[model samples]
Target: MSKYLFKSRLTPDGMKGLLSEGAKARREAVGRMVEDLGGRVEAMYWAFGDEDVYVTAELPGNTSAAAMGMVVSSVGGVRTTTVVLLSADEIDEAVRQEVHYRPPGG
Candidate 1:
């Protein structure tokens, strides 16, 4: 499994739903959705800024994450951006790889 970080902003309808259902209900609903995708929500938070919510989840892979984003966005409730999270060991492995590439106009 891989971890992901999601930043989201709620639409007007989503805000209405959140206000009616409450934050706890929203969290549980999100958890169920993640579980259905063979993942688990590690943490979720509501914030006051450019993004309304932040979620850290462990999922099977990028496909599951993209599916979640598409479903959520298509529902007209929330817009989400997903960031793949890498562990320290993963980063170490990545740094050890040799790449054959050059910068543009280099």
Candidate 2:
């Protein structure tokens, strides 16, 4: 399983639905959606800023993550930007194996 951070902003219409449904209900609904897609929601938050919602989840892979983002974005409610999260062990392993690449103009 891979983890990701999803930063989202709700559209005008989605804001209406959120106001009507309330926070807890919306969070639960999102959790259910993630589960249906074979993923697990780790954490979720609603904030007042450049973004409206933030979510952390563990998904099967990049394909699954992209699919979820596409589905949600297509609904015209939330727009998401996803960041893949890597653990310390994963980074350590990455540092061990490398491909050579010359710097531009080096």
Candidate 3:
């Protein structure tokens, strides 16, 4: 499984739904939706900033993450950007890899 971080902004309709449904219900709905996609929500937060919500979830892979993003975005009530989260070990592994490369201006 892999971790993903999602930052989202809700449209007016979505905000109205959230206010009506309450945060807990919405969180549960989100959890169920992710579970359907073979993922689980680690944490979901409602914030006061440019982004309305932040979500941390663990999914099978990029496919599941892409599906999640697509489904949410298709609703027309929310916009989200998802970033894949890698562990320190993954970064270390990446650092050990070597590839032939050329500088952009070289």
**lDDT by residue for model 2 over 37-105, one digit each (tens)?**
899999999999999999999999999899988999999988999999999999999999977999999
lDDT score for residue 68 of model 1: 97
Q: Which ranges in model 2 have alpha carbons more than 4 Å from their true place? A: none
What are the per-residue Cα lDDT tens digits for candidate 1 across 41-76? 999999999999999999999999999999998999
Candidate 1 runs further than 4 Å off = none
List per-prediction Cα lDDT, in the order shown: 0.97, 0.94, 0.94
Every model's Cα RMSD, please?
0.8, 0.9, 0.8
Which digits, one per residue and each the tens of the lDDT, describe model 3 over residues 1-106? 9999989999999999999999999899999988988889999999999999999999999999998899898998799999999999999999999978999998
On the 0 to 100 scale, the lDDT of residue 91 in model 3 is 97
In candidate 3, the residue pairs with backbone N, CA or C atoms under 3 Å apart (3 or more residues apart, or in different chains) clash, namely none
Quick one: ranking by TM-score, best first?
A: 1, 3, 2
Which model, 1 or 3, shows the larger lDDT? 1
Comparing 1 and 2 on TM-score, the stronger one:
1
Task: Give the poorly placed runs of model 3, Cα more than 4 Å off.
Answer: none
